[model samples]
Target: MPIADLLDRFRPGASVYLPGATGESLALAQALAADPDRLRGVEVTSCLLPGMNGVDYAGLAPDARLTVFMLPAATRESFAQGRVRLLPLAYSAIARHIAAAAFDVAIAHVAPPDAGGRASFGIAADFSPIAWNAARQRIAIVNPHMPSMRRGSSIALAEADLVVELDGPLVEVAPARPDATARAIAGRVAALIPHGAAVQVGIGGAPAALWAALGDHRGLRLRSGLASEELLALADRGALASDGHVAGIAAGSEGFYRTLADRDLIRFADTRETHDAGRIGREERFFAANSALEVDLFGQVNLEWQGGRPVSGAGGAPDFAAAGIGSPGGRSITMLPATAKGGTISRIVARLSSPSVSLPRNLADVVVTEHGVADLRHASLDARAEALIAIADPTMRDVLAEQWRSLRTAMA
Candidate 1:
């Protein structure tokens, strides 16, 4: 069907869910926003939109609303201006939330049908399947440019209520290069991984660098929330195990997509399957490496807020951290620079000013910084404080030690 006709199917007051991140349909979103009158009173929900295509829902129509689960750079200003509604939830709970809401329509960008007439969700599988199942109308933009993925990452073409053929390039996001501090942290994180480990890497510069450091390690398996070019490099180097990789999303440059085209090494699953704490806990030798904005003396990780505003969501950090640390042979590693703001501010603080805590102290295992690694897995309160302080910046170590002494004295 024509793009205009496909868009005309949307009715007033309809609730629509669009796949976010690299799986967003830019052409479809542009068509939806072309005429405000056509989509008056419509509610659109998505997260991590890469470009400025469908951000201004307020401009589309006075009654139109945009709801987001996670704040992306493109939509942050819109959210601050009250043009977008932020639904704060952990990444693992997103699928459940969508199922409860029961959207009217679910639009996803997917690869063309394979030999078995199946269309892969491609790079952005996070919660698309859950939303699509709950939505009244299932619409798919079949793009040949999308990589044909393997395993349970696909949906049948017959299942979609409407199919619109579009030939366009997928959105590309270049990975950020890690600096010297980040590389040092990555090295410490990589040292914690054992051979034949099931690794879950979070999104960040340090995590990206960690992949490069692990290229020499053998029999490593990736079970992550997002896949990047670095992961492909690991596979190319024969570092990943033969059991295959499992992830929720594929985010990297166009070259990365080309590398994954028609490959069966990675399987994409929903957030529920990928980020389930209990399931991950059962996987032996699970190692999770994540990044944090700030960590307190109590070992609490703060990934959501900085200064008083929300920069990112909790995401899968908490889920993976608990699972990795809980597993009998698994380990959870948190990496961050010892300081920020040109070495003026300490990231390891006595207390977090932000109310949000991504990971509690109990779940923390190994904390890594450029200075050193702090193993807090089996430490008491006093011991944990000392271990964390040792990895902190050299200049702040004495101050942290003094603060620890004062806290102990007050408790006594």
Candidate 2:
């Protein structure tokens, strides 16, 4: 049947939850333009990458309109003049919003069928699981290009109201190139990780390099949102699988995609399970490592914003940090270089660059860099500063030390 006919089968006037990235939701949004009436009350959360490339209601259909829950960068004066809608919510809550019946339909991209006839939600798993829960109708665009991840959740074909099979290339986000400073920060963070510990890291050059550096260690486990190429490489070398790697989804190079084809080491899981703080607390040797855009003397780390611009959201930071801290054998380390723009600006500041919780001071166990590690657990602001300054780049140590002393004197 044609795509239009499939839309006809579903009910109208219901809120729809679309994939944030990975093109599953973008495809549906495109098709909905053909019949604007069907999408009168549709809502979607997308990174808007697909829509940014001259897509969305206008490109899909001149008459198409929607209430889009998009990032600030995704909206424009032209979009505001139209029926576009925007909702500001943290990345972590997008799924919860949908599960609470905030949407009527869910259009998602999923991996192809597996041996047990189950499909994976490859790469991006953010709100897709939430859509799975609350949407009255579930529609999946089965893409062979998506890595067939063996994640935790298994949905029956019967549950899906519609299944659209489309062969297309998977959405790939390349890792950013890290300068010397980022490499040093990654190295410092890597030293804090002990062998045989379960790890959770986000995708980035810093985190990827940290994962690669783990080659010297034996028996490491991984638990995270987007699995990177370097991490899977560790698994291939028997460094991770020998211990255990529990991950929600896999994202990286073609080699990483092909590695996901082998299910023995990598397993896909739901957010509730993968990111459960209480469950993570129970696991011994849980080490959660995430990046920070900025850090303050008080030890608060910010990963979301830079110069007031929204960069990324708090996806699993809170959950993992809390879990790592609560875990008896685990520790949460929020890692970032001491400076920005090739030593032009200091990332370690007298106060927060802004109010963001990449790693709140209270939850942070240690902050690491090439200079050294700051053990912040139960430490006072002054003590934390001392440890952090020790890890500051040699060039910036004196400057940070003076700033720290100024703050300490004022606080006293």
Q: Give the top-scoring candidate (TM-score).
A: 1
The C-alpha RMSD in Å for every predicted model, in order, reads: 2.1, 3.8
Q: Evaluate all candidate structures by whole-model CA lDDT and list the values in order.
A: 0.82, 0.66
Minimal lDDT window, size 10, model 1? 49-58
- The digit string of per-residue lDDT tens for model 2 on 1-412 reads 3576557644444555666544344455555655666644434444443222234542243334444444334444436566555444433454455567545567678877777678767666655776677767787777667766554455555578888876666545576677676677677777777888888886565776787677777778777765666765676666764535566555555566766666556666656667778888898888888777787778888866778755455667778888899988789888777777877887777678675455667786888765668899988767888887777767777988988778778877
lDDT of 2 at 352: 81
For candidate 2, what's the RMSD?
3.8
Tens-place lDDT per residue, model 1, 58-141, is 447766778876666666666777877877777777768887878889887899899888998887788888888888889888
Each candidate structure's TM-score, on Cα atoms with residue i matched to residue i, is: 0.94, 0.84
